[model samples]
Target: MIVMDSKAQLTVDIIAKVAEHKMTIVNAAKLLNKSRRTIERYLQQYLKVGIQFVVHRNTGKAPVNKTPDSLKRQVQALIKEKYFDVNLLHLAELLEVNEHILVKRETLRSWAHNIHHVKRAKRRRAKARKRRERMESPGLLLQMDGSPHRWFGDKKSCLIAMIDDATSEVHAEFFPSETTVGCLKVMRDCIESKGLFKALYVDRAGIFGGPKRCNFSQMQRACEELGIEIIFANSPQGKGRVERAFNTFQDRLVPELRLNNIKDMASANAYLKHVFIPQFWQSQIQVKAKDRASEFTPLPTHINLDDICVIKEHRKIRNDHTFSYGNKLYLIDSPLKYSIANQKIEVRNTSKKGFTAYFAARRLQVSEVVETSKFDTEELEIQKKLDVLALAEKLGNISEASRLSGVSRDTIYRHLKLVKEGGADALKRQETPNLRHKNCVDLDVEKTVINFSLEHPHLGQQKVALQLNARYGLDISPNGVRGIWLREKMNTTALRVEKSLSLLKTA
Candidate 1:
């Protein structure tokens, strides 16, 4: 009583008719769209198995080529877990290459269609413009750019790349951020390994001394020194070779790095230099140039890239084989024969050599010169003022004092007026005392403390206080002695000595 499908039912009815002689084998074969031999074979099958034979033995079974449910589930989980936002083609390739899953692109696409949202490849807008041909030979022109991408998982970094226009050979590295040094390193590697290219093609970034840059940038100066031509692109599309290469890298290189577990810049750069570029990229991507011979000039023996690629500025040498750099005084390690004072010397900064001075490319050894603090000189200015006043008092001639002390006439007149208004006490700089506090320390006790502190300036406040108490039977405490010194502005040994000298000079 099993209800067969339409094809099965038709086959059973036709075989029954042929056995009962209701139809000829040719007519039965025509109804079932079978040949005479097939109808006869069906008749023999009918007799042997009856209606049950019409049903296929493998009915209600799955196809052998059907994908496994477990695998489908794993793909679904991987898409949501790790491979989200990746297109189907890239996902499939990543599965095969990274995860060792052998799912086809079409099959992966079908599986992803039922998931939340299918990740599609990023569609780039085609720019319609006049197509320019590649450079004639390798090293004719190299296009360079920085691509900001999350190549190392979630952390974003820039991959500065330089690509040969003719051969499409590339050198790239990852940097924390896009900077002048990062750009310089990329070019430096290109120049060192393959010699100097004829010209460089790049966008008008401020690093390249474009309109945004106020002065000539180091990158521009470096290229000029190496005799490499710099061609600034008006628009990004003008340097389309490297731009498109970056797009491809973001699509393909990101997954490869993720698979290889490359997180930091050092590991990423090593792989890029040793494994990826030479092994996979050069073998797969680079094409033959129109001319096989390279246009790269051989690097000269005399040209040291280390010197050329640095921050250079001119500094004038002082009389004592000293020069100030980065606001710090430094002395030349050895004396010079010729007159080096006031001679212009070039100073270069690099990570290897901290700061180096050069005179016509000859290195000058130097060390940081620790200059004396101005605290030592601050008292000097005050002493000069006192000396000028003392000279005027001794000479009794205002004009002669003005000439001798180098003190301006106006300043001498001001000090002389202050002396006339008050006595010599007013001439010495001292703060006005609190006249309301009549219970001040006794003049005899203050004078003894000042004399004791100046004589034993090497001793601390506590020792001085103890000695004063022991010798003079004074009851003043350590803080009381310190307070007296603070009032006298002789709180330290140097300060006490300076004050004593000034007092002697005035006397």
Candidate 2:
């Protein structure tokens, strides 16, 4: 005996009612939502097959296109383990290519919604500014932005990227920080590869001309020199193309970077340029422009990009033909070029030219003025001693007082004793025994630290010390590493990288 569903049971009752003349065939057909011909067929089947005919022949059979249980389990495991944070769309593509699991994104989303309880993303409401149309041709308009995110590892990195409004072609690189230099580099790279874009659209970030008020910024200077218009977006929706591109990148690039074990900015940039842009973005995502013809102007042959893209500042030359920069005096090399004193000239810092002064457009030769020190070195020592004593007095505890001051506990105790002594020059010690006074580290150890500094200029002293201690059996404190950096004049990250860039390139 087979149990019948409500529809089948209703059909049985209706045909029986028709046989007893309680209900007409028309009324049965209407109630069953079937034609009169279908009702007649049902009646005939009821007579021949009895109650069994009420049930369809294919009711218990599996669907021809049903997903396999094994495949479902595999995909679910992958979703949990590998793609827990990946976008469903990108996850589907990644599964097909990387794991050989071919499934539709919609199917994956359905499974995810059911199993993982992930809700589908709803469309955002339109902003106050109405939507804008894309440019007709690539290079006619380009959208540039920087998104600070944990693109690869835990540390946040800035991705400076530009997307063509018409084609959605993207050019981007990872930077340690979002600065005017990074912005300039992105624009330069995009312009060099795809020819000069006509107009650049950017948000009201200080990196652009936003913070300059009425004055022009370095970015604005470069754009103006290159004959490109700088368009500022009043709202994020004004430049929605690149904003949406960054949203997609945040969803897609993070997982790919993790899977590929890309950690540093260098590797991340290389992967973006060689792999993600070509294989992922261009192949699968970029769109064709409505107008096939590109509007990018060819870079002028005579234009000097070095002069245009640079950090520029104005300085007034003194009567002594000297100007101060970076706290060092630079002398205009004397070759009696008129009495050009008291006039303002542009001081430009570029990668190629280094430090150069420009009068109008002509380059001016300059020399550094190294002055003799007039103050005693003991001043710094006295200040350090004063700080330790002040901190101990403030906290009323010797240990926690100089804890963050980077001074040793013994040094703090000695200074505290001296202050209590009340001598005429109690703070004036015979001489401080720093790492230099202590036994110098072995030559091999010093070289190893210098090489490490050159390799990872961005790492802090403590982090470098920790890595060295873990990687090699190096017995060095953070202060010891800092002392080595001070001796080598590589104390700061910028100085270390700037001084070693030439050495690195040469090697």
Task: Write down the TM-score for model 1.
Answer: 0.61
Superpose all Cα atoms of candidate 2 onto the true structure and report the RMSD in Å to 1 decimal. 16.7
Q: Tell me the tens digit of each residue's lDDT in model 1 across 1-507.
A: 677889888889889998999989989988888899988888998899888878777877998999999999998999888887577777877788768999977788888888865855568987789999999899999999999888886789999999999999998999998888888888988888899998889888888887788647888888999999889999999999999899778876776687678888898888888987887679878999999999999899989888888777788888887888888899888556777888999888886658778997788888998867764454665566678888988999888999987778888887777767885445655556744235557879989999988777788899998999999999998998888898898999999888777777898
Each candidate: RMSD: 15.2, 16.7
Top candidate on TM-score is 2
Could you estimate the TM-score for every candidate?
0.61, 0.70
Write one digit per residue (lDDT tens) for candidate 2, span 451-499. 9888999999999999999998899999989999998899999999897
Worst 10 residues of 2 by lDDT: 429-438
Model 2 ranges off by over 4 Å: 1-5, 19-27, 117-125, 351-353, 375-507
lDDT of each: 0.85, 0.85
